[model samples]
Target: MLDSLRKAAGTWVAKLLLLLLVGSFAVWGISGQLVTGMGGNSVIVAGGTEVSATDYRLAYDRQLSVMSQQFGTRITRDQATALGIDNQVLAQLVAGAVLDEQARKLGLGVSRDRVAALTVEDPAFQGPDGRFDRNQFDYVLRQVGMRPEDYLTNREQVAVRQQIVEAVSDGLTAPDAFFRALALYEGEDRTVDFVVLPSSLVEPIEDPSADVLAKWFEDRKANYGAPEYRKISYVKLEPEDIADESAITDDQVAKDYEASKARYTTAETRRIEQLVFASEEAAQAAADSLKAGSTFDQVVAAEGKSMGDVQMGALTKDKVPDPAVAEAAFKLQANEVSPIIKGSFGPMLVRVTEITPETVKSLDDVKTEIRKALALAEANRILLDVHDSYEDARAGGDSLQDAATKLNLKVTTIDAIDRTAQRPDGTIVDDIPESAALLAAAFESEANVENDPINIGSNGFVFFEVEGITPARERMLDEVREKVVADWKVAEVAARLGAKATELEKRLKDGATLDTIAAELKLEKQTKRGLKRQADDADFGRTGVAAAFGVPEKGVGLTPAPTDGGQILFQVSEVFEPAGADASTLPEQTRTSLSQGLADDLLDQLVARLQAEYDVEVDQGAIQRALSF
Candidate 1:
């Protein structure tokens, strides 16, 4: 919570997520397993775990959450599909289970005491008073769909796996050689010899005759056809707009002020030193010696653990390894011995030598806070009433005018916008126009004239209607002739470039020199800087770098590479082979990365993994059902 107020000023996506958290949207659709449904289902399996609807739905929600973070509140379904969340989520669950099996085989273990200690000690799972709050823990558990017992079991597994991860990943460091290679790949710069073979290089003859043009249009009829859209008017019922607000009496204000006085208090915090022993026996033995009226320093020294050494002193209850132990100890007198309590550090007795209690403020001290809280409550009551009025207005099939009149809300009219104008914020909707359906419906059909209400977005259910049509009439041929000619020329140039590449390749095979071809094409020899196999950020970006790599290894001559600027002729003046992979440079947790890379780059690897784990049988009945509705 170390966030600044200014940070949220432009965080629209964060605001959207907050709305989703409070609104509890109920979009209807049951997912998972082969059930009797119109929607067909597919299963991704690994080990013995089944990927069901429950898992898929969770994965979808998680994916949407991430997309919203990256692209703001407005995300398209296509974007989610491209990210491969559906497949990745299943793969992750499978890999997690596989790792669990491997961990079990290795006999890696975490103790029950450690789990208990960690849970109670986490500030998130604690109450305002800094004590372990079971209600908070249970609330989070219910939110994520796990019971107390089930959560504890999973937590245990997580702890054990974490230990295995720590042991394996500890000091496997990055080598200098690896860093050098990475820098080379990531930092390489390239200058290239190229020429723009724009289509303009070729002369345009004439536009296709009417007969040819008509045939081309008919062949691609699908592109010209428009999608179906709905004309809808909705009466929205928002809770914040309809509540009743009544004035509060002076007596009530005083009462609230008195009751909330403690809100102004700040709890005292403790500074402590913690030492986790290697074994419970050693911890218990140390505690026993300290309890025998021994000087805390003396006990440490006797046990070969000193103040200057490890395993030692000075703790406030809140800083104790276990919250339960802390609470019990903080309640003790100074220098008091706590019962042998099991904590994250194992069995121990704490001696709290300090005491500090929260200081509460007087009623007058918190009067301002009371007033602010009352104002918000009163405002909400007023909003609730407004919401009810809106709901009533929407009851009948009412026009926007009728709904606005009934709700006492001012109806604002907007006109002359495209499918892109749904959002109030002027942001580009990359790859998709979410407002396409509504905008098209408003303008395309003749039936939807000027009576549409403002349409709300995903969270807002406001309706928008078509006020007028601004049809995109085709431009006169003479007006766009220059552009058409330019496009035709560019295409022609690209073809010429392709022909030139073919001729160059043939001549290079026949032992042509770099200078010979250069002089023949009236091109100069161009030199480029650094290049890499994996990260091709050379001359331009990927396309240019790819062309560089595409150069023939043994045979010499210029290779034609594709580029946005123009076609580039890359000559393979030198060749560099990668050194063998360094063991020290490899990531200790390479299994998951390697597996994912294999799936992405090698079709055979992915299919092999899929076959090895799952006996996949597609049921046509289920498949058809899933696709329907």
Candidate 2:
């Protein structure tokens, strides 16, 4: 169940909606008041509302587990703390509590019926019939370690927060003037004429003397310093390593195939579209119209219904909301339409757009797959015992090697490697499994400290003990002489380029044209025409684009380029403002987008006001203590 709980925590409902269920952290405003004299189990106190430590821990653990699964490694508590998961989870909880508190003050009471309706409406708790199923709801709740009451409470909070958001942003709209101004800025284009200053055009440099090179290396020793590397020995236990040892008989494979026969069989299915009507007479009239050579589209349009208003796309028999609708729908051939059939909703006219024949595989067809699956299952079961045995041995103070030997597992050791899994020669160490996890644990643990075991995906566990530590040291000038000289040349060239670009910029600011500057400096003039404010040009990247829009017409600016010690000295030749007529031509999508942005700003301001009125107080110590578990 813990494994099930972990896997469920990463689902879309838990990771996305649960985080948003409490509203964003930006919704909260807290004063400097520190609420004291609370029990250790209390995390936040919003007016009379208190969020419990148990709920906070659950949220924190879910987020931590999700991050670990995403990065393909075990994330430690220290890593979670460093990543600020504690603060993020606590902030969401506090904000949710604050909203609930404010809602209560305004006499906003959510009925249990409302929460129950939302629960029944959620797709997460729906079965194949596309309707609410109590069994499914309970199963999903159990998977995420939540009771029905707790889940409903979360849904109620979400409903309340949504009410607050709606109230704050109600009837919000961006003014025409505001959109016109934004359009002028966003849609404006610019033409720029520029000249490049390459390092190759700079004055040539001679090789530095020994004293100069040594001084340069001394000044930047930290850059040339060696990163700390650890020497570690580890024991890895994988189900794959023990899979071949687990023998599977043909009888067992056949039994497995029989038990999972559904996986080997496919039922015939139809792609259906249904139009449901409220009454029998309306449905019969529509069906009669279709029979009288009127197209379905015409019939729907005559009834004042758009295609989207009535179309239910692509459902199989079991997926149809009404059993009678499913039966009538499946009875039709491809491209065939059915007469109005009595449905749960009312009357439904179903159409079959496509049909798929049934498919079934014989035992011989998937014998190899079944055999492998059986072997893997057996191996996984054995690995669980192996993990427990290894832990017992470690608890008894046995060495990693001794524990491995006792469990008949091999122990692999790397003589010298860094956290990047690289040797001194920069070659990757391939033999180590779960190298990232092992390295993180090794570096965090002191030398000779017993390392905790980390889960590797589903069927493996790795444990390591750090044997030695080599403190990081700075290399002498002679040690990396070539790299030092190369770095020195780069810096010197950049400094010269910077100075040259500055001189040109000063001359342009002194009222010289780009053409004159290019001719004086013996550089080629480049022109970019009709460049939008946010457009990314191959000639001018984001930096140049920003400069083009930022500088006034006929003003000069400099942008650094990724090319070797390169710079672009440009003058904005023309600025094009959006015309008044262009605002009328703006697309509805653009208008909606701008309106949403303005509404978001309004909502933020409203939240700030609400926070001031609510007087939210968070117990930092209590939150830290709750998350420490």
Best by lDDT: 2
555-586 per-residue lDDT for model 1 (tens digits):
33333344453445455555653444344344
Residue pairs whose backbone atoms clash in candidate 2: none
The runs of at least 3 residues in candidate 1 whose Cα sits more than 4 Å from the true structure, single-residue gaps closed, are 1-111, 118-150, 157-441, 444-450, 453-490, 530-541, 552-565, 575-629
At residue 424, what lDDT does model 1 achieve? 22
Candidate 2 per-residue lDDT, tens place, 101-177, comes to 88888888779999899888887878899999999888877766677888887878778877887787766677888
> Candidate 1, which ten residues in sequence have the lowest lDDT sum?
21-30
| CA lDDT of every candidate | 0.49, 0.77
